[model samples]
Target chain A: MLLKTTLIRLLTTAVTLFGVAVVVFVLVRVAPGNPIAMMLPPGATEADIAALEALYGFDKSLPEQFVIWLGGVLQGDFGTSITLRRPVDELVLSRLPATLELSIMALVIAVALGTAIAVIGARRRGTATEVGLDLSSGAVLSVPDFLWGLVFVLLFGVLWPVLSISGRIDPQIEVDFTSNFYTFEGLLRGRLDVVQSTLSHMLMPALALALPLAAMIAQLLKQNLKEVLLQDYTTLARVRGFSETSVILREALRNALLPTLTLVGVQFTFLIGGTVIVERIFSYEGLGNMAIDAVINRDLPLIQGIVLLFAALFIVINLLVDLSYTLLNPRLRHG
Target chain B: MTGSQTHPNTLDVMQLNIALPNGHRLLRDVSLSLRPGEVRVLVGESGAGKSMIGKAVLGILPQNLKVTEGEILLEGQHLNAMTPWTRRKTVAQSAALIPQDPLTALNPARRIGPQITDPLVRIHGWSRTKARETALALLDRVHIRDPKRVMESYPHELSGGMRQRVLIAAAFAPSPRLIVADEPTTALDVTVQKQILRLIRELQQETATAVLFVTHDMGVVAKVSQQVTVLFAGKVMEDAPTERIFTDPRHPYTRALIAATPSYADLDRPFSPVPQALIAELQDDIVRDDARHQGGAR
Candidate 1:
């Protein structure tokens, strides 16, 4: 049954990805703007434009272009970006590490801090600390990440300036690197300063992404945990001599994590969508910005490629989450 | 099974009283004691505080219910007077509870092996290998046919009876002096209930662990108990030998309960709830008792 469920989930993911590919391929074309016009020199003649169109294969039928692009994609080619004059795959890959690092760091902060706050809230249900944290989380959730980004920029960036609010690192400092991922490259090169610089730059954007996520995670887990604590198993744990800490962290958290896992998966996908704004605010060069640039300049190939990548990542994450249910619930593994 | 005895006064609840933070009494002047290898069954209706007694004995009352005026003694040590952390650590090692619902008693995420070994591994610092072996042995002792398979399977994978058996084994894993079985068979069928009761009895007798069995079922009491403590609205209505309580019950409430319980000879008998005025009187008694001991528990 587990195997059958997994197979069904995989098939659903494939169908959804295919649907997204078709929708994105059509949607970008229907939207008004022209990458061809933008790429031409200011005084270029109509004949020059048509030559450039023919060269780029845009002069073919829309179906022909899609089929050609689809073929290349199947062969691991994402076509060239008209505006950037680079392969869409190369552009996405170069920015992929930064976006992944930011998203993961944000998730880690959200889960860790959110869980800690939630545990405190659960333990002190009606206390002032619980009420205070709850109110703060509510306030944070209401504010958009870009707004938070701006606030963080002024407070941590412009005002106090303890942490950089934008970019992957200080553009002034140069370093020889092995990987596109700054922290990994710094660690590999034994450069502590570079690692620190990377972290400092990531702090504000990560915080802007994390605070609202943490609030949501806290809200999700806190309610479930409070209910779980009243369960017979928690009482059993107490009777069995498990420490107060152990009961809350291991037993209570394990049961409370299921619903929160779904939220985390959804939040990750949302954060990728959020990257356009987050990257723009922080001036961090990631696929999110590349996506916006593609859409505004009507870089059809780049937009199609990025959207497909995003859709595929979302599908894969969902699959992993579906697999995680068996881990969280033993009953599911048997069924 | 130690096949040897330890303390005569394994557990002693002296004029125990439990109340909410708002000062409403939950248990009033309730007291019961257990000697090593003896089973003392707490008999009461739904709200008679029978389960509360088990929790009190284990020193694990819910936060709302305070032990305002009682000292629970374990082999003569005053558990109520000790610091909470100290009391908890001490009670955790010395006592174990077999809660009412087998389905809810075990953590759903963990397998039987780690869960059963929890007490020994966490409390005794046993290595995982040793703990798993000990857990498997305990499962075998509980008559689990495929102990290896049972150990590997999670709580949800096992039947209710199987889960109860795993819980029974876990409760005995630490070799506790007191085993608080709080309606351990309430969720089982008649046959499974009997088997679990018998298993608990056999294990308690073998280990000589003082058993505080809390249940409303008189049949359960008849099957396992040596002494019975009958409660009414949190007050002790009667405390006597099991045979005496069943054959010649003194309290009007006890008499009514026994009358309510249908026997083979009395197949058409309907349950008679205790008189309301008598319950009101019991409630008044608790209020007066609380007023008299206003500042602190006696």
Candidate 2:
């Protein structure tokens, strides 16, 4: 049953990705500016622009160009970045790890902080501590992540000056990485120094992206937990002689987490998308940063590649969420 | 502790008064007792606070509700006099609850094996293997086929009857002196209810455990209890031996409740609800009693 469901999900995901690719291809072409014109110097004649357009296949009819692009895409070729003069696939792959690492760090921070606060808040529902949590979470949730990034930049980067705000790591440190996933590579290679440098640089931007998400998670989970705590099972746990802590942690938390898991999964995709603005603020060398540069230069192939990657991430994450739902809930598992 | 084994009564609840924070009473001077191997069913309508008595005894009352005045003795030990921590420990070690809504009573995310055995190993301090063995044995005693498979299954994997059986097994596993079966069969189908009640009764007799059974169903009281406490708006209107309560009920509320139950044998006898006049009278009496009590306190 599990395999059948997974296979169906994979088929749907492929269809969705293809749909996304086609739409993005048309949409980028429909934009006001031409990629070849954006690429060339203003002093260049129409002849030079025409030659570049023919070479890149932009001079062909729209349908012909789409068919040609689709063929190349089927063969793992996303064409080339019109501005960067590099393969779009290579550019996206290299930058993807950096974004993944940051997003993962932010996700870890958000879940840990969110769950702890929610447990405390829900356990003390009627108290001042719970009230304080509600108020603070409300405040945190009202601000967007990029604004938080700017605030972090001012507070930690300018005032404190304790952590790096620009780039993924300090250029001064030298390390050979087998993979672009710096943090994982650093950990596997037993090079704590590289990991430390990468983390210190990542902390503020990740936290900026994380704080709003954490508050959202806390609020929702707290609400869910309070409802679950009032359930007959939690009362039975108490009557069974389990401690209050265990009653909440053992019986209640898992039930409450089902909904929170879904919310977190949905928000994580947005958190990655949110890195576009946050990355620009931190000047972090991740996919979100590259995406901005591609957009400004009207790098059509790069834009399509990046957008497709983002859409793919969204679909895959949702698939993972569904898989985990089955793992967490027995009825789903059995069915 | 040794003397408690020979104690005449396993549970003693004296003049227990539970009230909401806003001064509205839920249980007004309610009291009952349970001898070993006996079932004392608290029967009432939905708002009659039958379950409140069971909750008060088990220390599972809502956090918002306060025990304004009461004495609950578990095996001759004054539970109210003990510190909160000690009281909780005592309650955990000596009592268990068979809850209403079997569907929600077992944690959905947990396995059946750990749900029953973890308490034994953790709270009762039994060895892990012994707890597991006892759990399996109790599961078998509940007439669940293939106890090992049932233990490995989640609550959602089983039918409502099966979940209730698992709960009965868990309750009886520890051989707790007191088991509060609060409308344990209310959520089940009619066919399943009889089996669950019989299973509970069988386990109670085998363990010689005192059970505080709460139900609104008069039929349940007749089937399960040796003694019946008929409650009206949280006040005990009748306390008598089960046979006497059925054959010669004294309280108007009790008579009305018995009349309300459908007689399966007599198709001609009409089923009637408790008369509104009797309920009004009961509420009026409670109001006067509350006023008198308030005046006395002043």
Model 2 residue runs over 4 Å out of place are A1-7, B1-8
What is the lDDT, from 0 to 100, of the residue A200 in candidate 2? 98
Give a tens-digit lDDT track for model 2, residues B189-237. Answer: 9999999998888878878898999998889888988999999888999
* Candidate 2 C-alpha error for residue A161, in Å: 1.3
Of candidate 2 chain B, the 10-residue stretch with the lowest lDDT total is B1-10
Question: What total of clashing residue pairs does each candidate reach?
Answer: 0, 0
Q: Give the number of the best model, judged by DockQ.
A: 2
Predicted complex 1: DockQ = 0.70
Q: Per-residue CA lDDT of candidate 1, range A56-173, in tens? A: 8989988998899888988999999888889989988888888887877777888898999888888777689889989998999999888888999889878787887667888877
* Worst window of 10 by summed lDDT in candidate 1 chain A: A326-335
lDDT by residue (B1-298, candidate 1, tens digit) is 1123453488889888888998788888888888878899999899999999888877678877888777788767788778878777888878998989999988888877888876787787889888888788888999999999988888878889999999999998888899999999999988798899999999999999999999998888899999999998788989999999988999878887876676877777765666787768777876776688775643
Leading candidate by lDDT: 2
Question: What is the RMSD of candidate 1?
Answer: 3.5
